[model samples]
Target: MPHSPMEVTRLTATDAARAARVLDEMRASTLGGGRAKLAPRPAIRESWGRMLHNGIDPDHDFRTDLLSRDEVERRRQTSRLRHTLPVLREGLLSLADTAQHIMLVADADGRVLWREGSASVLRKADGQGLGVGADWREETVGTNGIGTPLVSRRPVQVYSSEHFVRALHSWTCTGAPITDPRDGSLLGVVDVSGPLETLHPCTLALVDSVAKLAQARLRDLHLTSLEQLRAVAAPVLARMDGRAVAVDKNGWTAAVTGMPYTNRLALPKSLAPGRCWLPALGLCSVEPLPGGWLIHPTGDPEPPLTAPHILLDVSHPRRWTVTVSGQTGSWTHELTPRHAELLYLLALHRDGRSASTLADDMFGDPARTVTVRAEMSRVRRYLGAFLDHRPYRFTEGAEVEVLLPEAPLDLLPHSVAPGVVRARAAAGGQAWVERAQR
Candidate 1:
C-alpha cells in the first residue's frame, strides 16, 4: 500500500535523506516493472506514467533551446502576470532568498519568464538549465514543480528522488498555478526551487499562498478596470432607450437599461459596430464605447430568417468554447470550466434534465439544486432562448452539435463532475473495445 502524501511530506521535512532513499527505491522498482514495498504518491505516480508513455528517458536530461532575450522581453511585456509581480515578490521573494531557493515565474506554456532570489541558487539553477526562457513543460523536462502544476491546475512540490528524470532528482521545487480572475483562464505558474538539501514541506504552502495573493491582486485590478469602464459608459448608457447594456471587452457588464442587469453578456470573439446578434440580447446594434461597447436590442424577434445553430467544442484540454451561428452573424464565447461541464451534460441528454438531477450529476449530491440552478441561470443569460429551462435543455428545434476531443480521456480533463467522469470511463472502454476488434 502507498503511504499517504502527508506522511511522505512529514518524513521529508524531518529526514530528507531517508525519504529520498525510499522514494528512489519506489521509483526504481516501479519503473523496473516490479512492485515496491511502498507506492509513490498518486501525483508522482501519474506523472511517471505519463513520462513512460511519452518516452522521457529517466536517466538523461533533455533540454530544449531557450527563447531569445527579445522574445522573453516581449512575453513579459504582454503577460498579465506582470501586473502581479509586485504581489508575488512581496509575498515570496524574501522568504525564498532566506531559504536559498530561487523564485521563478513561468507563462502558461511553461516557459520561464522571470527568475530571481538567492544569487547562489540562481547560479545552481543556471547549471541545471532552469534559467529564464527555458521550457519546463512536463513533456519537455519530465516531472517537476512548474510543469506538473500547470498540468494539474494546482500547487505541487517535487522533492529529490521524486523527480522522474535522474538529473532533476538533486533538486527540490514547489509551484502553484495562477489563473485569471476575470475568466478563470490559467495565467502562469510561480515556483520556488533549490538544491535537494533545501527541501521543506512548507514550501508548497508558501508558494500556494503567494500565488493566491497574486490572483487577488489580479482580481482587484480587473475590478478597477471595470469601474473605469463603467465611468466612461455611464453617460452613453443613460441616454440610451430600450434594453441596452454597456460591457467591457470580456463581457463584464458596466451598466444596463430597460432590462434586468446581468453580470456579463456573452460577446463574440470578433465584434464590430453595426447589427450583431448577442447571446442574451438577441438582435442588437453594437457600437464601440471608450473602454467597452454599447449594445441595444434591434427589436427583431428572430435573427433575420435563420434558426440559430449552436456548437459546443470541448475538444481542447484547457480551453472550451461555444459558437452560435445565425443568418445575421456568427459569434463564439469561451466557456468557464463549470459552464463547459454543464453544457456538455446538456448536450449528452438533449431530452433535458431537472435541476436536482443536474446537481446529482455534477456534485454527486441531489440536494445541491440551488447551486446547479444558479449556474444554469448564468448559462441561460449567455445562451438566451436556445436553452430551455423547464427541464433545462437545448431548444428542441435548434441544431446543437458538440465537438469532442479525439481522445475520450482528454474531454474536460480538469472536470470532476460525475457525468464527465462516467463519460470518460465509458468512452475509454469503448475505444479499447474498438481497437481490440480492429
Candidate 2:
C-alpha cells in the first residue's frame, strides 16, 4: 500500500513476488473473513468496496452477455471513440504487440469494442473471456483496469491478486479513461493487458498519455467542425442589416455583424424559420442557413417578467426533467444528462458560474470553454428569459431547487462531472452514516 498502483516502482523479481504475496493475503482475508493480516492499497480497497456493493462475487469469474455482432458494429459506428482508435493503436498497440500484450478499447459501459495486439496474446485472451463484445464492468467482472479506471476517473493498473475475481489473478492490466473533449464525458477506456510476467509500471503512464492524445484529437475535430460552420456563415452574414449572428447546429457562433461578438447563442430545440425569443439578443428571427442558423435581431425589447421558480429533477437514471414556473404559468423541458449536470452545478453556485468555471466543473479542466459555451447556449434556448448570462446564472429572483435520486449513489450514475461527483460523494457519506445508525 506504500505506492499507488500506478506508481508501484518497476518491480524487481523479488519486489514482484512480495507484492503478489501481500495482495493474495488481502484477497484471502476479504473473501473468507479470516484474520489474514494484510491490507490492499487505498485505490484497490476502494474499488473492492464498490465491487462488493455491486454484488460481484470474489470467488467467481462472471462475464455478462456480450453484445450481438450487429450491436457491436452499431456502437463502433456511433461512438466518439472511433476517432481515438488511430491514436491508441499508434501509441500503444505497437509497443504492446512487441511485449506480447493485448490492447483493448471498451465503451463507457465497459463492453470491449475493439481488441488487437499479439495474435497469440489475443488467442490467450479469449480463454479469459477478454475478446470483443465481452463486458468488463467491475460489477460483472470484479476490480480490474478497464472498469475501475472509469469509476476512479484516472489511469489504473491491476496486477495479480489486485484483481477482485479469483480467476483473473494470472493477468495484469493497465488502463485509462478516454473522455470526450467537448463534454468531458467518458467516451471509453484504452487498456494494455497481458500475463503476470508482462506487468510494467510504465504501462499506466503510457496509457494515460495516449488517452490525452485522443482528447486532443477530439478537440482538433471540434475546431475543424467550427471552421466548416464559419465558412457556411460568411456568405449569409454579408447581406444582413440589423444585429445578427450565424451559429452552427450546436449554437457555436460562426459569424457576427452589427453587434459585439458573443461566444455562442442558444437556439430553439426545433430549428425553423420563425420568430423566437433569444436570451442573448431578445427577440430574433431565426432563418435556416446551409450548415447552421442565421439570427436577425428585431430590436424588440424583452417584456419585464415576475420572478420564477425552477425545479431540476435528476432522480431518474436515463431522463432528466427541468420545470420553470412564473407569472406566465409553468413549462417543462426534458434535459439530456449533460445539460442536467450543468444546470445542477449552476444551481449549486447560484451567484453564477463563468464559462471557465463551468468548464472546470463539468470537465475537470477549466480551459475547455468551447464545450461549456455550446451546452449553456442550448440551456438558454429552453430556459429563455428565465436564464441570464454574462457569467451564466438563473435570472435574479428565480428560486431553484434540485430533486435528487432516492439513493445518493444513484444520482447521475454515468456523470463524471466534478460537481456531480462531489455531490454524490457527500450524499453517499450521509447515506452510509444513516444506515450505520440504523
Candidate 3:
C-alpha cells in the first residue's frame, strides 16, 4: 500500500463514469447478478458499496498509507498462492508457451485476476495492459483477453489484427472465462497475451487449460456455493443433492440418500436414509431444517469445540465450507491428543517455521525426525492434489515451514514477479519480467 516515489507523482485518471461502469460489470459477471443503478454524476449502484469498500480507493492517499500493513500481510499470502497458481499456470502455459506471454487468474470482473509469468513477461503484458484484476478486452484495453472474453462470454483467441483498437493489432491474445457450473456464472477468465510475432496457433488451448484449472481450484476451495458454510465447531449434517448423507471426517459428506431433492434442502430428513454423494453446500447445524445424523469424525484426544461443532479435515482442492452452530455442545470433533497438539501448533504458528525446529518442537526428541518429516510432507501431499498453495513447503536449504497468514487466510492472487520487481508505466501492471531479465 505504500506508494513508491512514482505513485506519489502518478495521479490516476478521474474517470468516474468509466470506473463505475467497470465495477458494475465486475459484480454482474462474478456474482451472476447485477446492482440497480441510479443515474447521476458520481453515483454508483447500491450493490457496489460492498465491493467498493474493498478496493484500493483511488481518491484517498491516506487510505493507501493505512493499507500499507495489508500489503505486508498480502505479501505473505503471495507465497501460498505461488505454490498452487504456478502449478495451475503450467497447465495453462503448457497449452502454448511461446505465443503466451502471460497467464492470469482474474476475479469476476475483467481485472488481472491472477498472474503467472517471468517478471519480464508480466511487465510486457502490463505495458500491453495486463495485471491482476485489471479490466481488459480488446475493446476496452485493446486486443486483449481480459475484457473481450467477458463481453463475449466464451473463449477467444485474438490476433493483432482482430483487436477492436488499431494499436492492439500487433498483440496476440487468447482468453477463456472460467464459469461456475452450478449457476453457469463467469468466475473469471484465463488469458494469454503477447506480441503478434510470438503468437502460436494453440494459444486458445492455453486459455482453456488455465480456465479449467482455476475453476477446479475454486470448486475444491468451496467458493462455488454461498450456501456452503465453514465452521470450526458447529454441528454438521451432510446431504447429497438435498438428502442426508454419511458425514465426513468431522462432518464432510460421503453420500446422501432419500427422496430426490426438488430444491436446495437442508440435512436431517426424518423420512428415511437413502444414499448419494453430497455435491457441496451449507453446513450450519441449525439450518432451516433439523440436524442430520451427527457423527464423531475427530480422532482420539479430540479438538476442543469451545463453540459447538465444525468440520475437520474435510476434502479440498475443490471448494467446501464447514458451519458451526451458535448453540454450545451441539458438535465436537474427536482428535487424538497428538493430533490436537499438531493442530494447535499449526494454529499457533501458521506463519511458518523451519521443519527442523518444528520437528524438535513437536517431537521433543531427535529420535523421531524422520517420522516428523514424513508427517509434514504428508500434510503437504494430501492437499497437493486438490488445494493450491498448500500449508507446508521447503525453504532455506529444505527447511520445511508453513506458509500462511497469522490470522484467517483468504485465497487471492499470489506470486508477483520474483526478482527485480519493476514499476510499470502501463496502468494494468509493470513489465517486471522485462526489467528483471535484463
Q: Please tell me which predicted candidate would have the highest lDDT against the true structure.
A: 1
Write the residue-wise lDDT of candidate 1 on 77-139 in tens digits: 999999989999998888778888888999999999999999998987788777899999888
What's the residue-level lDDT of 156 in candidate 2?
83
lDDT of 2 by residue, 246-350 (tens): 887666788898999877665544556987665567678888877778889898766666667889998864457887666534556657668888888988888
True lDDT of residue 235, candidate 2? 77
**Per-candidate total of colliding backbone pairs:** 0, 0, 61
- Global lDDT of each model? 0.83, 0.77, 0.39
Ranking by lDDT: 1, 2, 3
TM-score of 1: 0.90
Better of 2 and 3 by TM-score: 2
Q: Which has the better TM-score: candidate 1, or candidate 3?
A: 1
Q: After best superposition, candidate 2 residue 252: deviation in angstroms?
A: 2.3
Instruction: Work out the TM-score per prediction.
Output: 0.90, 0.75, 0.37
Compared with the true structure, the alpha-carbon lDDT of candidate 2 equals 0.77
Candidates 1 and 3, the one with greater lDDT: 1
**lDDT (Cα, 0-100) at 69 in candidate 3:** 42
Error of 2 at 293 (Å): 3.1
